[model samples]
Target chain A: MDTASVTEQPVLAVIPDDGVRIVTVGLAVAIGVAYGILHWLNKRSSEESRVGAIIRHHWQPGAWILGILLVTLALPKYFTIVAITALSLLCFREFSRTTGVFREKTICAVATLGILLLNFAAIDNYSRLFFAGGALTVALLTVCTIPFDKPKGYIQRTALGTMGFLLFGYSLGYVSLLCNTPHSRLLILFLLVAVTLNDMLVFLFSAVGPKSWLLPHTSLGRTRIGALGALVVTTVLTCFSGMVLFDGTPLAALVPLLILGVGISVLGQLGDLLVAAIKRDVGIPETRPNSPNRGGLLERFDSLILVAPAYVHFLSLMLGPIGSDLPQRVITGGGP
Target chain B: MNDWDMQPAKDLHLTGIERSRSYVREAGLSESLIRWCWLCGLRNWFCRWNGLKIEGLENLPSEPPYVLIANHASHLDALVMASIVPRQHRDRMFALAAADVFFENPLTAAFAASVVNALPVWRKGNQQVGLKQMRERLQDEKSIYILFPEGARTRDGNLLPFKPGIGMLLAETGTPILPCYLNGTFESLPAHQKFPSRHPITVTVGQSIDSKQFQNRKAGWVELANTLKETIQEMSGKPAPEGLG
Candidate 1:
């Protein structure tokens, strides 16, 4: 692929304008089927057990997520980017609140501002500025909090702030950047549906498989077989979906599709584990605030945090640099 | 190097409305920012609207592990108490608000938790358990609590008898208690008034009482409450009513 060709203007459009309609419908159907199965199992299962009863209530949030996904598909590109930015900030708020980093008001303010700027760069289609966010965030988090003159928890707070910046600000902000791509709407839908399915499959597989722990300490209930099960299931599901979603592109080919699917599954699980690891380090391994072992937005979207960047990079490599054809510097109105 | 012992927020397990109405809800950076801004505006509001004046700020403790108790006459009393402290200590200041009144709904709960940084104290729930959590949070997090020991706003503009709940929080701890009286706030926004009317307000803060001086029991707490109530009544420049104590 000629990476330079990505800058060329007005390439004949291939994908239909309403191309995501079928994929969105497919995703809704998939969620419906899963919900039906869960409802069926919940009916048969005894609610005397705590797990059985709580898992029965899973459809509440499942319906909520489906509603959000459907609404996002209907919105404009900028709306999706703004929603993603808001998600990143809310997820960061959860992390900071959970890890005791919220105590440092200054560090949190800088991290929040950094997250907003990253998304702003993505909105502007200024990839260079978006790429520069990681360094800038760490630098600011380290330097800006020095005036407090209370160095007691300096290292801890700084480290927490940096990690939060990297995870929510830089990493998760990629979802906003992905919106700058030609295949943004369908692509986001594809990733969201796939990841949600992957999580459900992982949980389902763990309940029945050889009772084993993925990392006994980090996640109290995650099974090794469940992780492997999600990897295999998500790979196949995402690969088939990618064929339809990426029809006009080379990514529709079996080999590239398979690679894309595997990348997403592996990276998604790793992201989930990364969040699990943080909670473990902070002595709050698993919190069932609403659902069993499912926590706030951070826990729910942890997988998406990593998969977004990886998918963007994969698309950039397969098809030229992602979002290159889009108007450059929408905010600054300058060329690279 | 400091030992790596990272204690999460006390209410880490709670989320959303549950966290907001939680008695142990700890305000985060966002809430702190909102609270700071709210208090700053409130300071200006008190001064300009009510022509607010202060008598003894020098009597407040330099650090936390202290409680501020004042006669509750109107809704303005809590805001007045919270805004009196310096900006540096604003983050640690939390006012104990009546759960039914302030945290009954989402909009009011958000305001109570974020802007006011007030924790819900259920008047009819398990008082001992709630007070234990509040007391522990005060000491562990180095917090300053603004409490209205009168239990509820006075409807008739007469001071209510101090409840022993305040002593339950300070018992066995050396946390100093600052007795204060807010003159003219009842007239500004009395229990009957839906909205505050303009009235000059003057707050007189007495020196802290070593809570350790009182016994850590019901009788001792009652005695402590009466003593502080007497101090505040004296600050009101009212003659001690006979047989009230």
Candidate 2:
């Protein structure tokens, strides 16, 4: 419980160098093959090319894959935290713009400031403050309108602000929390690769496998076979990755790894569907033109948003707290 | 069932420079924050630099769902008019700026839209579509539009005859039109000048004019245009020149 003892414990000692190397090399090869295939397909096809259409549709995902890998490999934990915070801010912006929630300047301003504060708490490694920030933000948002006396859209603005803060601020803040943990690179890299692979595998299976719809209303392209196929593939992938990433931990066991694997994939898929449902409900074809092909930050990383918290908490529950033996509240000195 | 109705922003899909100049451009959190900063800067600049003074501030409508028309002479005219809007209605305010000028390029369009919250008003080629969108937005969104009925800034300081397009927006609609005449703006930053001089600028806001009785026709449009022009002229406290009548 003492901060001094925790600080002296070697957190990085748990990281297996071979596991990191395998994951990094595996990611590089996977991304390289995707780009190479895309290049070949684009060149091989004619004007009316199906591959061309597919390329046009998924260029953003390709870029995203490359970007995530680069960031994970090249950047430190601090930069990764900054990147996630940026992503959360962008997602919130897209959400606010699409939902017309941002029209409430006061609410939007407060939520933005609140999001920054949440990220600050995460960076500070103050879990207590990070957990407390959400409630404080919601309360602030609720009363932020009372002084304006513009009761007309008060409920709408407050609701939008709360939802935005919870989804983007608190939920996305989990990534930053994970970044602050011991062997964080391995854990975070696993999360990123697993989520991205889950999406790609689901799409591939849906395109090539049996054609029964998964959910006709939410995801038209997704099929039952594809969904289950992705589940199986993702579970296996997550299990392997977790085994390497977790190494000597209790999560490295077969049953626990399977549970983590299945949980990550299921939660990731649900997150994607949730965003799709939101877009449909709001009657927007896309959230924002994030790239030439797909929607904005949320669309690209929607799978990760829910998965971050679920995987993190699950890992913490099975194992002890994230970075338990590592330094506690590195910035805040573990005080009131 | 949930009674809380949620609507998405209109300009969600637009990207890059297009988002800035889009008629459907909706301000999100970052844009709103920047706009607040811009408003603060604009107010400070106007008061300290232009010696800005606004008359009949009480004549300004408390909420939106209305249009504010003014005499255009300088680039500063729009800024002067936009700066006078109260805090409650600041974010909702959209200044109708010429697309040919303000929205000709990405940078200027970004400045106009992000800083000024101005929606592009294309001067040529089937303007009705844009006006139709504006009209719909003005009514449905309960938004405020700061427009110059003259369509373009005058070469001289003289007020040009109001364009028919203003009538097109107001015809058959009960949307109130608040007429305001801007003085010393032309002297501050005329169309010919790039940088503004430290000339005093004054905005005189008159009573709001309702166009309920007017039909949405050419004849009705002419009447509405003339009425707005006369109100602006009177607000200017100037004798009508021989030919403008």
Candidate 3:
């Protein structure tokens, strides 16, 4: 396969008169305006409120802007890869900032940049060996180079860095690689839609559901009713979206997709908890004070880091090799 | 010291004597009831204040007689751990507190006995008696013992050297040690702070490591202590104790 020809060719056609195109453009503009207005209001409100002053003192606006840019640009296939790269960098930054034990920032930066390059190479249809080898080398080098001064700090930095590589680099790289596969762009978009809907439903459940003081020690602040609400909403939305977007998907595939949605939602919650766990360990409440970002890098990209890997691995199994005729068979249940 | 001798003072025609005696009794009761209530209250308040997060509660065994060993970063560690344990099991658990500190005053002693259900273990002298008492508590089929193997609050919120008492306790009791790691407690209430600041605290309980795993080891007690500290460090995502190096 000539990878250069594929990268050079434009994948999406512009539909100037299409209703979907109009709707997309209109929605984007409206969201942009709303965000601008919210930002202004937040600034004014912060100036007026004492509580907001304390918050603003600790907030990192730059990280928030970068995070928003990544999420917004991720809608386009090409930009999605860039967004993933940015996410990886931000996550690495967040991990390093909160963890005082990581003394080798230069090494961490090099390893993180290598992972991003590997991700881009994977997306551009470069040799899988290159991606795999680079990932392995980075992992090995990080583990070996960590100082032996603080045994706990050494192990923690290594473990966290390795986790970031696997989660942000390899898993996200596979998601980008999907864009090159036939009908895989639609699959990537479908995954995002399902995930967004899942997040929305979970947030709604947490906001409106009955509150329980039980397990008040947890950071989730979620009640049993809220969890049930999230589960039901995620399942229904996944199945409905599958029916609409992937009509040819077999019942077998649909079942797994439903399971995947629920699992991702749970893992997303776990991801949130994991980030909180780190903050708790470091005695830092949030990374906003140090990073100029309100939610911090870990807080913003945590769910994506966790879900991206699981989604890609599951997608690979569901849709065999990139050009294989197995996707159709699997969708139609022709054979194992 | 005698109940009958105290009754005459209670019966004396002192205008607020009854109310004062009742207040004393209530204060004593408050230690046990107030301790649990305070724990629950603090958990809720801090969860709201700093947005606390907890995970891996499922990893904790429902059965009893397990030794809960955790890193001691602050004085709040015991309260935080007790708050997370299922309410059903809280009554059966006893926290091992420094005997000199908790038993220094009569009121504190009563409160410790009633609310905390604290087992007063000597920090320095009389190791034999303290060990015997701890073993006796562990030998009971229904009792749970919570110990901070670090011996005291860490000066810098880092895991300090593990006291040999834990190794000795494990050797004698041979119970499953549930290694717990508490995060953010130092900032919430550091070593010198008398009151906890509004900071979120998280307590992670790792899988239980059986005491029998280290039984009869030829190596020194530091080896077992290192293993236990490493277990907690892994759970907390912190560096292991420096002494292991």
Candidate 4:
């Protein structure tokens, strides 16, 4: 497709009656039903079936997958950005708690302001402000602590605050950026599926494959065979999904899409491992016990953390500026 | 290079409500904001409704890692004590509230923990653990605890014999105990009254008692309690009321 056609395309034009989203929702519901039935059967047959444990553990993640699909389909493009920003804050709340940085009032205040500003930039479609937020927050945090003059945990608090902003505010802000693009729905659905599938495939392989260790210290559940299986399976799924999502763009070419897919799969797993490291370091079983069935919001969104930034940059590189054709600074008084 | 000693929040794994009520609860932005709003509203209510006049505000140490002990007569005692906490240290002030009364149910617990920034002192069970936890916090975390050594609210409008728990917390810690006396609190809102009357109340702040001189033992706790009671009695100009230890 030509550049003009790409820019002129309606947001839903590529979705084709929401075929991709429908399939995703259908697949999720089917899996959920199947698992629910199995869990019921096992409960009836035995008092303590290991299947019950598996179902309990996986239930929250399963619900989140279905929930995101439905929400993406229902919410307007702007609301989707808002929703993502809210999710970023929730995740950051858990991050602050686990990192003990919540104790630092100034750091927490600065980070929260940073998150709000980043979201504002996303909503305003002001890329300049969005890019400036991280540096500005770092500067604010550095200066914010100096007023207290405690100087005991000065460096620690500042660094923690900055990392919190980058991960939740700066990194997740890219999702809002991507969602504002012309074909955002398709792109977002593709992202959700790729990351979710990557994690699910890894679990499937690890659960059934040879009981050998991978990064036992980081994640005891993962095995070498499982890692290899996830890597290959994720690559294939990403390539296929990319083929559909990026059909008209230069990414439609096999090599670029393949690289993108593989990159997402690898990055997704790495993100999970990174969170695991945090849990282990913090000496906590889970990030937060906010939900009975699910781990913290961060746990559910862990894979997406790394995938979001990478996906936005890569797609932007392959296709020109995301949402560039959309009227820029819709709220901040600027033109496309 | 100095090692980066940063750790996750002590209550990191706790949910919102639970973290608010946690002994190790650390106030970040949200909690700090909530506490600030509560304090502002409480301050106004105290001043306008009860005619609260806080005296000896200058007596408070400019920082935390200290204890504030006052005579327990009504529920307003803790609130009155917490009101005098300097704005800078307000977020760090953990009011030691009665677990059964304030934290018996989830709703009250959420209110106490979130709005009041309270940590439950279970009057019935496992108090040693709670006192020990508070002691550790005072020493290590630089926490400021607003407590009543009288243990429970007075049945009559008179002072109760001070408990040794305060001494246990401060013994050998060298932590200063800021002895405050709240006058007319019982008249404003007695233990039995669900709603407070518009009776005037006064909070008089006195010099901090150094608990370091006392031994971390029973005899020391007795002496510490007696000294605190005497100081409060002297400030309030009321003889010690008869009560149990």
* lDDT (0 to 1) per candidate: 0.79, 0.77, 0.57, 0.76
lDDT per residue (tens digit) for residues B87-186 in model 1: 9999888899999898999899888888888888899868888788888888887889999998898886667888888888887688888999889988
Candidate 1 chain B — worst ten consecutive residues by lDDT sum?
B236-245
Candidate 2 residue lDDT tens string, B1-245: 34666677666656668788777777765666688888889989999997888898898777788888999998888888888888778878999988998898899988888888999988889998988988888888889889998988889888998998998988887988889999999998888888989988888889988878778999999999999999888888888889774
**lDDT (Cα, tens digit) per residue for candidate 3, span B1-245:** 21111011111121222222221112221233456676678668767875777777887777787878888988778877776767656656777887778766667766666666676767777676666556665765356788898888888877877776677677635677888888898999998899878887877778878777665333535667878877887777766655443
Which candidate number would show the highest TM-score if scored against the true structure? Answer: 1
DockQ, candidate 1, comes to 0.57
Kindly report the TM-score of the first chain in candidate 3: 0.66
What fraction of the native alpha-carbon contacts across the interface, defined at 8 angstroms, is recovered by model 4? 0.64
Candidate 4 C-alpha error for residue B223, in Å: 3.2
Report per-prediction Cα RMSD to one decimal.
2.9, 3.7, 22.8, 3.8
Per-residue C-alpha lDDT of model 3 across residues A147-259, encoded as one tens digit per residue: 44434445455665565556556655666555545554455545544444444344345434566522334444445665667677666655554444433333235677687
Error of 4 at A170 (Å): 1.3
Candidates 1 and 2 compared: the better one by DockQ is 1
| C-alpha lDDT of residue A76 in model 3 | 51
Report per-candidate DockQ.
0.57, 0.45, 0.01, 0.47
Candidate 4 lDDT by residue in tens digits, B1-245: 35767687676556666665678877667767888888888888999998899888888888778888888899888887787788888877889988888887888888888788899888786678878877888888788889898888888867788888778778889988889989989998887899889999999989988889999999998899889988988898877655644
Pairs with steric clashes in candidate 3: A60-A292, A60-A293, A61-A292, A152-B239, A152-B240, A153-B239, A219-B52, A219-B53, B32-B115
